[model samples]
Target: MSPTTKNAGGDRAGGLRGELTPRRITALAAAVIALVFVFENTKEVEIRLLIPEVTMPLWLALLAVGVVGVLCGVLLVRRRG
Candidate 1:
């Protein structure tokens, strides 16, 4: 193919490579940071609810809260979109 001719294969590859855009990079960084935070905080703590107190590893509690936050964000975005 001549340099001036558009390459369909090149275009497809570029599209795939562009998948890791800034937003994705930021999300990935956030996930890594959250993981590190959870790992660093492994001590047990008390979580008191309305009726009872539960004790678990701090990492587990943080992970659970992060999952819930992600789910809420997804639901809100879907509803708005």
Candidate 2:
């Protein structure tokens, strides 16, 4: 191979070498566990607010809350940064 092509391939391989570290593996495992937890609780339940009530599957409610919490966290971080 030419020197230019060899250098390019090495750079690309180096960029990907550290893509999966211990911390990333742990985060992936945690995400899988969270998904399992969300799917297992499939019962319906009542959710009460100030003046209204709603019935939905337990997993859906939990997933919504999780999404909202993540959005709030991202917003706070962005504001701080």
Candidate 3:
């Protein structure tokens, strides 16, 4: 098949089809790095939001921020696409 041709599964027959793209691999790697960073830091840290301060484990704070980041990314993608 030609490089530009598509298969029935809607994938490029001679290109990356049902395969992990560079973007996907990069995302996976970033996720792994983030997880490792989160898990490595277990110390209690004080977080300040606006005028309020709260103390929690660093891992929990990191996880929460990660979740919020993921949610924001999802929302933006959904709105645009």
Q: Find the candidate with the highest lDDT and give its number.
A: 3
Best by TM-score: 1
lDDT of model 1 at position 9: 62
Local distance difference test values of all predictions, in order: 0.87, 0.83, 0.90
Clashes of each: 0, 0, 0
Off-target runs (Cα >4 Å) in candidate 1 are 1-18, 79-81
Q: How do all models score by TM-score?
A: 0.73, 0.66, 0.69
Tens digits of per-residue lDDT for model 3, 1-81: 788776575745556556798998999999999999999999999999889999999999999999999999988888541
Cα error, candidate 2, residue 81 (Å)? 7.4
Stretches of candidate 3 exceeding 4 Å from the true structure? 1-17, 79-81
Error of model 2, residue 58, in angstroms? 0.3
Model 1 agreement with the true structure over 8-80: per-residue lDDT tens digits:
5656655546567888899899999999998899999999879899999999999999999999998888864
Clashing residue pairs for model 3? none
**Deviation of model 1 at 4, angstroms:** 20
Task: Tell me the TM-score of model 3.
Answer: 0.69
Ten contiguous residues minimizing lDDT sum, candidate 3: 9-18
TM-score (C-alpha, index-matched) for candidate 2: 0.66
